[model samples]
Target: MTHTPVDQADPPTPHRDLHSEQGALRGEHPGRAENPVIKVADLAWLEFEKPDLDRAETFARDFGFAIAARTEEALWLRGTFAGPPCMVIRRGRASRFIGPAFRAAERTDLVRLAAATGHAVRDIDVPGGAKSVSLLDPSGLPVRVVHCGEQLPALPEQEPLLLNFGTDHRRTNTTQRPPREPSRIQRLGHVVLETRSFLRTLDWYLDTLGLIVSDFLFLDGQRRRGPTMAFIRCDQGSLPVDHHTLALHLGPGTGYVHSAYQVTDLDSIAAGGEYLAERGYQRSWGIGRHIQGSQLFDYWRDPDRFMLEHFADGDLFSCDLEPGWAPMSASGLAQWGPPVTRDFLGANPSPAKLREVITALRDDNELDPARLLGLMKAMSS
Candidate 1:
């Protein structure tokens, strides 16, 4: 979405009780890698493993992805617009998120990445066949960089409804009524993940992908606790990009929390949610704008119970912007909406997952017990 230029000069900045400078996370660390082979351009797609390809396809199509291609063992789903598959579902016994893939800014970046990471550039085995090199993050999550892929041409988009305002009437006669259709998702806006090693994983992403933090959330009233979550955007020079292409949260286990897709507008999100509800799908949370990225969002559960969001009118950031810091809590999740759900907060942490988190804390020093207690206090507040 495009908007008229507004006064950006000395914009009022949001306060972070505990704030770090924009590049604070990029400072030298003894064990961190020295340099990235190349920076990525944008997020591409997410990989998943599911036992039932048919069920995944049904939910994906209803969720707004067009079937890019289908094989007996795999499924490739994309948004209405043209691009490489935005999602890949592979047949497997267990259902889980595999990882996320990114698009490289330059084709040569792939060669440098493969060489630097000691992984050979290999052919992508899904829709829009492309060459890619894969790397693992600090938490051992697979991240891929692709040199090239087919761009599916744009489909007919849903035009925004001309709405009349209290003071200004844009529509003179016609009553506004949106269709009961899956709000056409324009593109994948961002992928949010939960990781045990929040700081290490956050630093790894910042250092390697050249991603810049847009916002940092920490324990309320505990500025000394450090950042526990991040909303990060791609570094695209002076060009404005989505406020966040990726988000990370500190949680009991490491895996996908949810992925957000862009719709046309508020109508798209609401009408789309209604369509899904009419189809008997569960609404996870949303129909509200978030404070961090400022996206009007609506979340739903897919066939396999993975969360997918339909969002619109999100904020975009220029390279000149600095990171904003805020307190993290369930109540802080949105500016206005129904109370945040337990599932969204990763509440009721299983004993096994709790043990995994304890192990990660014992082995890696990201936060101390005081900070952890502060984090718990913030969450339960």
Candidate 2:
């Protein structure tokens, strides 16, 4: 038998038509406004109301937050980075997320915002002295834009672990061991929320706070209907900022989903996960890289069942890049990780959730039967 000559040419490579930021903007919303009221500098802090302050303080410490100030009525939690506290938990009869506060780039921005919105600028009664203009979003969530005259000084930084790589060993003879402690949080990265009026809420952020969308996700068969999810970032001109400072998705209910805080690296995420696990805290979903921001993330639940995340190595983008669009599905959440948890997806049925679904369907809002069915399908997918 004559032996056939071995094929010398390489196999044909599959072509992937990757989506470009500019190309994705075709016939879609520009994810920005022509003239915004005021461009926010960054997220200042989140506010919450909890019945138990001591318990909240304990979890805050375990979640790697430094107590900036604590009183009988409130607790202010800060990260290692300088700025305002990451969050404030106030004493209340019920436990719930109040809302998010954004930092104004200039004090005059607050005056402009107040004039445009007809809300008066008032002094914020927090540890840091600041003036704020408050307004309610379309979904009835409280939103504040604040300008602080003084910021908390930067804390001592937590150095990243030295590692050894193949042919580029940086450490010799040194044992690799990250301590089993809470991951030191650097700063608040982003907050995710679910709203029934997604389009209106998204537009409000873009027009009011001058936020720009970094990415948009629509249901599998509903691209014409518009995006159901958006990852928004601050418009810092040419300065690169976190890929998403705020993310919103359409759902039956309107409320907080989760918030992420940046840590040092992967070792911080893993070792810190171990620390939380040993303390009997519940891990919701994590040890994976996200597709949108490309952050290595780990999520956990606090005593009040509020979700918080420890994330690192997130992508940064400037204002020049337009928003990229993609189809939303369970599998699209992360580039590589374990299956998304049912808890994180809110798949577990509860009485409150059932009531919210019924009310959203009956009322006049963006969510309808078709959109609800699409959301269900996306979750299952």
Q: Which numbered prediction scores highest in lDDT against the true structure? A: 2
Q: Residue by residue across 266-304, what tens digits does model 2's lDDT show?
A: 998999899999989999998899888899999999999
Whole-model lDDT, model 1 = 0.77
Task: Provide the global lDDT of candidate 2 against the true structure.
Answer: 0.88
Q: Model 1 segments beyond 4 Å from truth?
A: 1-36, 349-368
- Shift of residue 367 alpha carbon in model 1, Å: 5.4
TM-score of every candidate relative to the true structure: 0.88, 0.94
Find the number of clashing residue pairs for candidate 1: 2
For model 1, how does the per-residue alpha-carbon lDDT over 1-381 read when each residue is reduced to its tens digit?
Answer: 111123222223445333334423332222122365576789998999999998888788788777778999999887766676688899999999999999889888888877777889999786657899888997789998886566877778878999878989989868888998888878888999987777778877876777887887766555444567888888887899998899987765687989999888898888888889999998888778788887888989887878999988888887677776666776676888888776666665688867866876676645557666776777676
